[model samples]
Target: MSSYSAPLRDIRFTLFDLLDVESSFARLGFDEAGRDLVDPMLDEAARFAGTVLAPLNKAGDEHGVRYDKDSGSVTTAPGFAEAYRQFTEGGWSGLSAPAEFGGMGLPHVVGMPLEEMINSANLAWGNFPLLSHGAANALQHHGEDWQREVFLGKLVTGEWTGTMCLTEPHCGTDLGLLKTRAEPAADGAYSITGTKIFITAGEHDLTPNIVHLVLARLPDAPAGSKGISLFVVPKFKVGRDGAVGERNAVRCGAVEHKMGIHGSATCVMNFDGAQGWLVGQPHRGLMAMFTMMNTARLGVGLQGLGLAERALQNALRYARERLQSRSLSGPKYPDRPADPIIVQPDVRRMLLTCKALVEGGRALGYHAGLQVDLAAHAGSEEERRQADDLLGFLTPIVKGCLTEWGVECTYHALQCFGGHGYIAEHGMEQLARDARITTLYEGTTGIQALDLMGRKTMQLQGAGLKVFLGMVQAFCEQQAGNAALAEFVGPLAEKAREWQGLTMAIAKRAAGDPEEIGAAAHDYLFYSGYMVLAYWWARSVAAAEASSQPQAFRDAKRETARFYFARILPRTLAHKAAIETGPAPLLALDEAAFDA
Candidate 1:
């Protein structure tokens, strides 16, 4: 079993010590429940994850999920239902939900650390309720009054779960090619007919009901994405009195056998003339779906962070206890038969890399959370718009960069475990496998790159990028004289400038050549991701330096920041060079070029 503890020290450092979340909350008009509440909240969440959720993680992976096609029901791994019940009963499901829907109405900053804990404990189990929170977010934002009344409370309480059905066998990213149909019925409802694949939490026995936020086309809808419509199709319809009623027309056709996250039931759902209500405006379903998707994307990024944390914990524990050959300098521990593996430089390097990336990722994720909170609750309209734009710009970076780095971090942590890492018993292999899907799902890394470069960067005519650059510039200017952080801040500022210039160059070249944009998109996004993470590391280093703490904490922050800049941030140079090279070289090769 993998023994995992929440990084409470780091969490406290990030929340109160570094960000002063309490003061930020006060400025935002938060009530008497101030910063003092954060410690207890975090302690309670850590206990739940470490004791309740973490114990079931290995068991869930071993047991996987079984689907009964004849009965059209899904049975999750053992203890999952009970675990979910405990989670909901503890009011965790309502952590960040709106107060109007019976939720705790906490800010995203408050919910972020809890989310990291849950996902680290068990991603598969975490996903079941995670989607529900996301669905509630979409519904609360765009649902009609009746829809909110009917669905929000139960969803917030976890009596109901939710799924987003967008992918089909024929179309996953290209929603314009979707063939699902939604026909209007006489009663102010539509009958949906289609098959949705790769639907997580699509069908499960953990909740009383499952609500699917599906996308389909109207009979007279326009062609492509513009014609898409969103719907709320329930499993086990609700009665007028809010009781569970007849089963809806939607049913799980089959569940997929995936590479990882087996405990999360990925289902093929068949909507056979199922009754569903259109959400938001007609022909504006894509916009409504995005409202949920953007939030879910951020959730996915946290998932990556959580998995990386778990992997690091396992590796760090194993390295300290395992015996290995003597150190190059001498036998450091003469009392033992052999020295511990952690004394080795390469091993330290691996552990340090995980530490740096995970902590840096946490800072970035929390910053994004703060932006989201401000966007929702800021006093001024101008503040709200700026917050919204900042959040929008960082969303893709959070989703893409965190997830991509998550895989690398886990893989390196596994390498730290040596031969045992590849085996199933140590749990490192499972972490790697589970982390793999984070990049592929919730929109692939490639999709995120395209969004960052094309839609987010170019489409806005650089408005979002300019705002982001201004923030970095302001941070650099403010921290210029901090001798302790000069080394970290200066290099990061230079890299940010380099990235900005590269982005402008790409944008210019893309204007003349469409293919250049597509070719350069992935590398450009990565460059942006590295710089963002480096900038986050710089901010964290400065925050840590100001704290009254042990030299070890300050030393660790400075060391990790050094590792990121020296080893990790250099990749941006190559990425920038690739983007500057343009797409002509890539597009010039024909199919016959591979005929060797």
Candidate 2:
């Protein structure tokens, strides 16, 4: 079996050493976000995650949730409600919320590590509060003044919870195909009637009300995504003055029995002419909905990172404790009948793979979180725009790569445990199962690739790419004098140049043949992800070398970066080759040929 202690040392290294977030926060007008205050919050967050949430992970997976068909009510896994209450009482929901709305008003970067810990401790339990961040994002950017007053504060304070209700049985990624209908009600609220599938935390006992940010087409709506609108539909209706009223028409129809994350209710939500008010402009709901989706996309990336961390920790511990044959070179621990499996080279390969991806990914993910803060709070509009651009560029790569790696890391971690890993008691299998959904739910990896290529690259003309490449160039120049970082700097710079050329190449190809985008998108995204991680891995080595961390820690970072460069980063080469193939290779296989 495995356990999780918050990876505080590495988290701090990422936050302060790599990102220098305290300085960044101060520069962005967060006076109270200094390390003095942030440190204690981190400690408390770790304590709560470890002591409370960690114990519940296995229980949640095993017991899942209890659903009453007659009442259409769902009781979450044991202790889930209590833990959620504690989470709210501890004021964690407001960690990155605006101070004006009853939140602590900390920077999102500050909340990033805390979020990782929560997910690591219990992925299922973490689902309860995760969407609130997105719901709050949608409301903050798009909600009307009265709507904000009526609902936003409660969401920020965790007095209530929130969900994104977008998918129906017929469509998921294609929001334009959704058939949910929203008609005008007498009191100015919309009457929403639809069945939303795969709704996380759709109905639960954790809070008195669940605010659903639903996407539905209006009576006069056009045929596709452009015509959709956003609405705030709550389970228990509330008055304009903020007082809770009678139950609305929204209810849980059924809970899915899934492969993983059983503790969290994945409900089929039925909105039976539910009363909700409009959010943002009509026919602009997709725009507003994306505000929530982009936020959730980043959050989902961390889900993968979080699972990798827990799985790696468990596997590493197993490697050290489990006895196997002596090392091929020689016996390292002669006292035991056999040396620990950790002495074996192949075992080291699996462990190190997890280590390199997990550590480097943490830094990359944390850096993106910092960009979010800068995007919102930077000194100038131009600065904010640049930050947002960089963030957009990184989002798909972060989500796509990290989630795919999360599954990979968990697989390797489980492999390290051998047969025991296959057994449920080892808990590695549960992690592997849980990590599967991250990539699938928040726009599948394929969808993320399309977004990166189609929207971010082609439509925006690689604005985000330009911003990121500029950072890579600036970093390489700044670190030129540091001989210790020279090894990584040279390769990273080479990759950065290659990435720019590769982008131009693909854009040129797609210009001639539109199918080139689809053909190259998946591989191009992986290539970008590998390059991004390479940059972060290089930065991590520099951060470790420059910090006051112990020599062993520094050496470990150096060695892991070496492993990444040698083993993992080269995956880009294969992706690049695939990207250059155009569309002929894929499209040559006609639909009938496969069956024939």
Candidate 3:
């Protein structure tokens, strides 16, 4: 059986000691809910995650979800309904929802860590409610007065779940090719008729109704992405009296048989003249969708983080208990036939790499969460704009780099367990399988790369990049003289410089020849990702040095940062070389050359 125990100590350390999360809340005018409230909330969240949700993960995977074609309803795995009941009963679904909509109004800084724990415990179960948050975000951003009043409270309270409907059979990435139709109907509503595929949490029995934030084209809409519009299509139509009325013309055609996260119901949804309300102005659906998409991108990155943490835990537990060969110096456990594998340096390296990435990812995620809060609640407009600009620049990097590192970290963790890791019982293999989608969905790494190189860097004329580099440069300057961090800081500074130079080079090349951007996108994404991680690691080391913690803990932080720069961060060199090479080799290849 797979079990999860939230790393509460680590969570506390990251929030208070490392990042000073309380001070961040204070800065955002949230002092009334200080550490006293924050601490207990986190404790309860961790308890729920470890006790209720974690145990269901393996069972859910084993049982999975079953679809009834006749009834058009999907039955979730055993214990899921009860788990969701407990989850909503505890008000978790409303942790960060707006107060006016029956929520606690907690900021992302507080909500994010809780999200990590829930995801780490059971991603499949966590996903059911996670989508609601995304849907609520979109609605709050672009919804009408009645739309907010009618849907927001129920969504916040988990009375109904939500989903984003963008992908179709023929269109996954390119929305311009989407054929879903949204025609204006009587009574000022739109009639949405389309087939959306890979819709997670699209249809489930856990809630009474599922709200789908769908994208479709109007009858007189222009072609391409500009023609798209967002609509809110509920499974059960609501009457004017705030009661369920008619069963809408929406149904789940089928559910996908996926590689992992089997418990999460991915449905092929069919909309047959479903009644839906327009979210934003016509030809502006992509803009409305981005509100949810950006949040989903970050949420997916955390999925990678959660899976990596699970993989590392399983590997470390096995390494410590499993006896194998003797240690290099001698047999430490002579009583046993051999020695535990953790005594080996290679195993330690693998474990440390996973640890470093997870911890560093936590810092990166928290920083981004803080940015989100600042952007929303900053005292001055200028302060909010700066925070928004910086966060916008890093969002792709956070989503792209963290998820990529997540796969790598999980793979390494699986390797640490040797053959046992491949077995189904250990659950490490499942982590790798589940982590795979993090890179694919919510935008592929290639897409993220293009977004970073083509859109983020070049589109803004390097305004975002300049803001990011300035922050990094300031951090480097502040930490340059720290005796304990000098070694880590120097290399990180160099990597940042290299990253900046590479960004400029790619930008210049992309300006002259647009083809160069495609060729360099992936490499540029990797290079940028490494630089961000390196910078984060260095900042973490500085914080560790300033802490009053035990020497062993501090030493581990410093050592892990060193390992990141030496072993992991150096991969950027290859990526940089590839980026500098531009579109020559990639474009030069003939069409037949790819026939293999």
Tens digit of per-residue lDDT, candidate 1, span 125-178: 988987887788888888888889999999998989999999999998999999
Clashes of each: 0, 0, 0
Judged by lDDT against the true structure, how good is candidate 1? 0.88
Clashing residue pairs, backbone N/CA/C < 3 A, model 3: none
Query: What Cα-based lDDT does every candidate model obtain?
Result: 0.88, 0.92, 0.86
Q: RMSD of candidate 2 to the true fold?
A: 0.9
Lowest-sum lDDT 10-residue window in model 1: 236-245
lDDT measured at residue 27 in model 3 versus the true structure, 0 to 100 = 81
Winning candidate number (TM-score): 2
User: How close is every model to the real structure, measured as TM-score?
Assistant: 0.98, 0.99, 0.97
lDDT for each residue of candidate 3 in 47-120, tens digit (9 for 90 to 100):
99898889888888889999999978999999999999998999989987879999998878788878888878
Clashes of 3: 0
Best by lDDT: 2
TM-score for candidate 2: 0.99
Q: Which pairs in model 2 have colliding backbones? A: none
Error of 1 at 417 (Å): 1.3
Q: Which pairs of residues clash in candidate 1, taking residues 3 or more apart in a chain or in different chains?
A: none
lDDT of candidate 2 at residue 135, scale 0 to 100: 96
